[model samples]
Target chain A: MSDIQTDLQAPLQTPAQPSEDSGLILPRRSFLRGAGTLTLSAAAVAMLAGCESAAAGTSASAADISILNTALGAELEAIAAYQVGAESGLLQKPVLDLAVQFQGHHKEHADVLAKTVRSLGGKPVDAKKAYDFPVDKLKSQNDVLGFAAGLEKGAVSAYLGAVPLFKNRDLAKAAASILGDEAMHWAVLRNALGQNPVPVAFVS
Target chain B: MSMRPIAADAIGGGPRKGAVHRAGAALRRLYALPLAAAVMVLVIPAEAAAAPDPARGQQIYDRCLACHAVENNRVGPRHCGLAGRQAGGLPGFDYSDAMRAAGFTWNRQTLDRFLADPLGVVPGTTMTYDGIKDDQERRDLVAYLLSLKPCAPR
Candidate 1:
């Protein structure tokens, strides 16, 4: 907890410059290994793989459901990002703990949304064991920071988008609450990557 | 001779004794009535003095309502009927742990200072809105916010 707190409070350090051949930055196998503890069933993975097909057939109502699906998607992505960071053994204990805590938070959020969708007579979206991040092939702390920053940015946007869409006040408030935490996560990641923690205004 | 003496004593004592007892009771009642009246008069003013002006509080809330709505989560916490409420009592908004632990109630004086500079009063509050500078404005906003009763019967 102290380590997490320190990671949260510590000033942003500058990220090292990206190495040449950044295209090969994150390799597929290494990226999967970095994302921790994914146990998606084969059927679930197949379902997710059919998203483009499912999306093509979706109606307006399905679009609404898709918002939740998108949130779940972002969570899956974050879980993968955190697992990669945690498994790499590159981050200090404190940074790794913070990453792990956020991973748990994302998992909790994903679980709640999944239950909500199921209760609403919809199938929950499947989780992903691996994701495509460009920085997996890079060997430096800077590259990892870049990946985390991008992941946090996407999560923040997803939460913000979902907040207004929730009809239930309790759910809206809950989303807002989570949004604040996601915002903090974004700040911490940006700072870690040597960017401004508190931008003049919210970024996106 | 004994019966004759007892009868004479009872008849002579009755009217005179009853008048004296009645007069004493009347005087005691008069004293008690005034004492009770005095206590009531003293307590009423104190009660009125303690009750905040909900109207004025509404005016003070204008400064806050810009960034916050009564029920909506915006840049800051909701200010609807905040008088005498505990800090971090609202659900779902992730307040700083310092704010959660801070046991301050939102009475007039505390609110006034807080509205003036939230970070100064409660460090690490995410509210970036600068505090209201005018003392009278703060008072009015407080009055307005207090007017909004949270537990009003539906």
Candidate 2:
């Protein structure tokens, strides 16, 4: 059977009997569970084509997985950071829209990274339910923008440090691509804060 | 028919100095072509060897966009004025001591060498980039950087 079929079979138990109450003869619980599994598989496949199943032996180096997970973690944090900024009520009009857009980018980065981790036969790290962002400090619009700018700057540095460390050149390229976006977000956020968008020549 | 004497000399050890001399001359003629080709290759101008493709360089510059910008400083310094600028010439951006002490101008040759190996050229430079390795890619990136108009001072 195909790998997707195998993945489906493992999660599926003995077929559930049809439910009598809801009129339809379908095995509702089992069908919904199976659909969820299929949806996840489809999402992973769509995110990265030609990914070997996680059950398969690791094709990527352990180092590559570690680097990817580190980047994924950063993306997750950025997503959370943006979400906080979005909900803070401090961002007005276009600034709020910009935060949501940047957040969406981080989500894309996270999805690709998580799928890449799975494709490499490694477990993708899960994001923590709660992040320790200094929400108490974010009282004003400038405070929120500064906080987000700091996170984007940190993400830029994280990706910069990661790009060269990957054993896989493709991974390095992916990291670099993400780095560019993070830099752009940082510049834009700084600009919104009435600060210099491009403040330095080099980032550490 | 002409080569038979040299072939015979390989098996028949009797000293035939004339045959040996003829064989040596033939070998010299065989080596001369490649030697001349090598010289021609060495002397080819950098531009003729590989014309810089600014377009391709722009694509490759995506990797650098994380920290650098053509018009304004991002994480890194702007590329405006990069062509003739000193390594650490930007006034406000903090440069690593190694970069400050690099004591080199940003010309094509210097940029090519530095892009190929940043840490090697400027050790302890704050830029974390590992450096572009492909010869053509590096050349293209340098071309793109050079193509940018120097940014007007703010």
User: What are the lDDT figures for the candidates, one per model?
Assistant: 0.48, 0.58
Candidate 2 error regions (>4 Å):
A1-59, B1-154
Which candidate achieves the best lDDT against the true structure?
Answer: 2
lDDT of 1 by residue, A2-84 (tens): 33334534444445523434552333223324333333233433332333333333431443354455455456656766777
Model 2 chain A: ten consecutive residues of lowest lDDT: A32-41
Model 2 clash count equals 5
Interface RMSD of each: 37.8, 24.8
Superposed Cα deviation of residue B141, candidate 1 (Å)? 43
Question: Individual DockQ of the candidates?
Answer: 0.01, 0.02
Q: How well is each residue in A90-175 modelled by candidate 2, as lDDT tens digits?
A: 66656677778778777877887787888787888677666555565666667777777766775675576556655666566666
lDDT for A16 in candidate 1 is 56
DockQ of 1: 0.01
lDDT of 2 at A192: 63
Off by over 4 Å in 1: A1-64, B1-154
